[model samples]
Target: MLQPKLKSKVRCTDRDIGEVTKVILDPLSHEISHIVVSMNGSGERQIEMAQVQDVMEDRVELRAPASAIAALPLFQRHDYVTTHEVEISHLEDNIDVTPGEVLVPFPDLEKDVKRRTFFMNFTHVIAFLIGLPMAYPILRFLMKPMYMPFDNDWLMVGNVSKIKQDDVGVQFQYMKKVKEAYMPEAEVEKSVWVLKASPEVLDKVYQDKDQEFRDASGRIIWINKKDFPYIAFSGKCPHLGCAFKWRQHKTLGQVFLCPCHLSIYDATGSVLDGPAPRALDALPIRVSAGGDVEIIDMEFKAGVKSQIRII
Candidate 1:
């Protein structure tokens, strides 16, 4: 019988490993530190890390080892590159090499660089001369984090004593000051009537929880739970801007009625009669310490069922 042949280590080039399976298995016995795969300028594929495995004459059956894929430098791919100092740890197979570690070129990158060489050269000079000077100030102003003051922070109101709980119609003025120039008056105040809900009326509103309101300027309003006591919607009928008012009905007793076009709305600002397109608008309210009232803002006007309003 012939003596059994012992497995011997062999050296090969990337071109020798003809098939993909042999390429993947070449570094099975020896741990694979890195994998280098890139293309050349002529669109030629180069496998730098698999140089030893590539030159194999026949397929070698083996398992794959863990490895890290790395990109090689440009000069290496153009001309033949050499690893000056390769320190491979025999125990762990971790490799540490000099500057010219691997040479795997990517043709796409080479093409892109070649195409934009003219523009890139000019851009680099311009950026170095101009953009670098302004970069520091721009970054400091826009990117730097700044601290904000908390003096204007207000807390949400929770409890208050209820005094008058009846549906009493209330109206307040929302004044906007405008500066007058060539005239004698320095400033003038434009006052707009803002409606508010009474205690009893607000109670019914809380029960129904409707959230629609609007102003004469076709601006819709909404209410928030803050420092408001009661909400008041614009009692104006949108059909013809008629003021919708409330009155005692003959049979319904305390029913709201609009005198302008015979339009009628309920105590909760809902349209009860007439050709009104929607119910009364909703105003926002916040409560005070003693259950007294103040209007933080108004909830814009809206039609019934639909969220569309004259915001």
Candidate 2:
């Protein structure tokens, strides 16, 4: 029985180094008169001293040295030596085993591992330390509170009791704050009213009649209230709080005239002629429980064409 031919397969790192396979023979065996060698994956074939037809089926045929086959580290036994035809077999099928080796290209493993671990740990510590201060300002700003003193804690009223009813000048005491020991304290002063009108006078004063008042300096001071009884507003200009005396315009009827800037106020405390944002402020007062009179709280806001409406 004729022995079956064998083949081997191998992988080479450098393609420039080709492949080889061996056929073991006795000292006096049939001389390899004409041998055929073929590269398997490439399907290229070559013959020594023989034409292509001379080989058995022109496939699975190779002749090479055993030392050349051993040099390739990555190789398969069955792919090494196979006859072109008849009894095509792998070298591993005939032989029990074939040796193998593998090589990989890389730097030293210990140094590479230590470098990577050190860099990662260093970055982690830096991030933790830096994040503490950065978050402090942000947290402080978000958790802080605001300050407001006069939010919904005060009330305002009108002062009309300062005017009298019998047309007689009346005297009243007014209390104002003065510095006491570097702190503010109440100080009293007496102010005298010159003209007094009864509650019924408001109806007549607000009528179509033009009424005006003035101080000793002939400066227009007061204008009679509109559509009311015994109610009137000071003719002081609010822009700079300049006092004005009331005067009857020979042709214009009645007008309050300011001496400092000649600012004028209408009967309703509205700025009739000046650069003020709004009308004069109203004083707060009311009839006392004892049937006398009392002055209450007074506060004001400025606006365009607005007046301190005594209500």
Candidate 3:
């Protein structure tokens, strides 16, 4: 039995011409009659079994020359015909079977290819649908902080009525809701130094001083439209963000003192001495209808001369 495999090298008497692509067989006698050789740069050609001299393990030797093989006619595969009317021997000899053509011997090859293609396409769609729901929540969670509104809401600090006129500075603690990046909103305990002074005393302290309320980028965030007798100063010292307290200084009388750096601020929150670059930060405050003191909780960059709001 002379059986030639596909992809076996087809060599002419002169040199190698091409490779075997198809084995054309005589269906009635179950014998190989012709071989389709795919030539390099020349397309495919059908060679008769009479021109095949030897069929080796990896090559098929032809009895023709390279020039003769090149001169042979190009192979052509005909259309399909019904097996019930056409003879198998005549069909194999006259017509060739190309890709996508259904062969009578292997009827399931074309159907299997189509079924596999449909299954692969359907699998990709199902995988995308399953992954969409899983990806949406993760994307939203990561992007939520960028879309959340800025924290500028006014919070009640203390009652203005309770602060005595002689009070140099009173520290009032309050709970502020803060939302940091990727973290849940939390209530943080914050304190502010509330100073209750008369109009004459306020003028004497802040008379020639220019207090510009600005953010870290130098953009004005708020302006003191109305000057009230009560002033709310951030508990953070203007030098290094250290907590300052009200105490009786040996020379300055009642003053706010930062124990960390000895920065001193008198009853008006003005920098009196030490390495303090500027005055204490004054927060936006308002006297409510019910005599309650409301303030916009804020923070500012430390160590700089300008009052730069941090939050």
Candidate 4:
């Protein structure tokens, strides 16, 4: 029968206090004993049931004078669960709270964000410290494919019929595929001159008095025109790696000539004139039964007579 509603107006004998914010109940008896009144739209004050002279549907009448009502000890409902709240409460009950008695405090975003950033930076530093020593081995492993035997690196050149019989020493460029661990296969492009030639050219004109081009295995490994109809010669000059063109000279016919130093090679890639140290290098080529022309893309040391590995 004595249920009180929130926002019910409360009045002292001389002046109005504002409204009932919450009804205060005795904890042990579970009975409403006092009304919480707000003053000046800010602080809260409580009124005892003994001070309420009359209670109506919309308002409460107090027996105490306005000065006495204002003089009653200030009351602040325990609004905050943290001691860091902007407004500190001055109630005697609030002071007696032990560390174990309080509820969980609300989360603060600024403090949480700072804490997370600190941990993230710490983890990044730890990871870098753990990863630094592995860099050299990783780099060596990544570069190993580039150091693979170039003479054995077979790469696609073109179709077997890509060359026309009438065309004299036609030249083209092609990409050679290089594969490595943990990386996408990469393409390496080089210039090539594809033509039909007799394999005996190496033994006849190119082989020196000492067979300097011959490897220690007694096999003419660099001379690849033996079994295939199509032969490809590296378009790089042995002088200094400058690109050479198949040019029709007034006297020399179609010869591989380097513009950088006037070095020249005949159709069989044998050295003809200029300061070239060795004949043009032959790339090992194969014609598949299906007619796909493939060559082992390789690089050789320039400015030297014998074939040497560059990559």
Candidate 1 Cα misplacement greater than 4 A, ranges: 1-165, 177-229, 290-292, 296-311
Q: If both were scored by TM-score, which would come out higher, candidate 2 or candidate 3?
A: 3
State how far residue 185 of model 4 sits from its true place (Å): 7.3
Query: Candidate 1 at 226: error in angstroms?
Result: 12
lDDT of model number 3:
0.75
Per-residue lDDT tens digits of candidate 3, residues 1-311? 34566788999999999898776655556455678899987988888889999988788999999999999888764422234334444544444344222123333354376788998999999998999899999989889776664456678887876677564788889998787986788998899988777776567555745344554445766555434667788989989999989988888888899999999988777789999999888887777789888787888889999866567
Q: What's each prediction's TM-score? A: 0.33, 0.29, 0.49, 0.44
Is candidate 2 or 3 superior in lDDT? Answer: 3
Report RMSD (Å) for each prediction in the order shown.
18.0, 28.4, 15.3, 19.7
Ranking by TM-score: 3, 4, 1, 2
Residue ranges of candidate 2 with Cα displaced over 4 Å: 1-173, 178-183, 186-228, 232-236, 248-250, 289-291, 297-311
lDDT of each structure? Answer: 0.40, 0.39, 0.75, 0.66
lDDT of 1: 0.40
Error of 4 at 275 (Å): 1.8
Candidate 1, TM-score vs. the true structure?
0.33
Candidate number with the higher TM-score (1 or 2): 1
Off by over 4 Å in 3: 1-149, 204-223
Task: Report the poorest 10 consecutive residues by lDDT, candidate 4.
Answer: 96-105
Residue lDDT tens for model 2, 61-172: 2233434433334323333333322132231233321222111112245337678899899999999798979898876655542211111211222234555335332334
Clashes of 3: 0
Encode model 1's per-residue lDDT on 1-311: one tens digit a residue: 11111121222222221222111112234433223323222222223333333323323222222121113232234432222222322322232222343322233444566659988998899888887777878766554333211112122222223323445444443443232223343433221123344555556656645453344444554445322335555545544655555467887666556676777767666667776677665544555656544443322343344434332
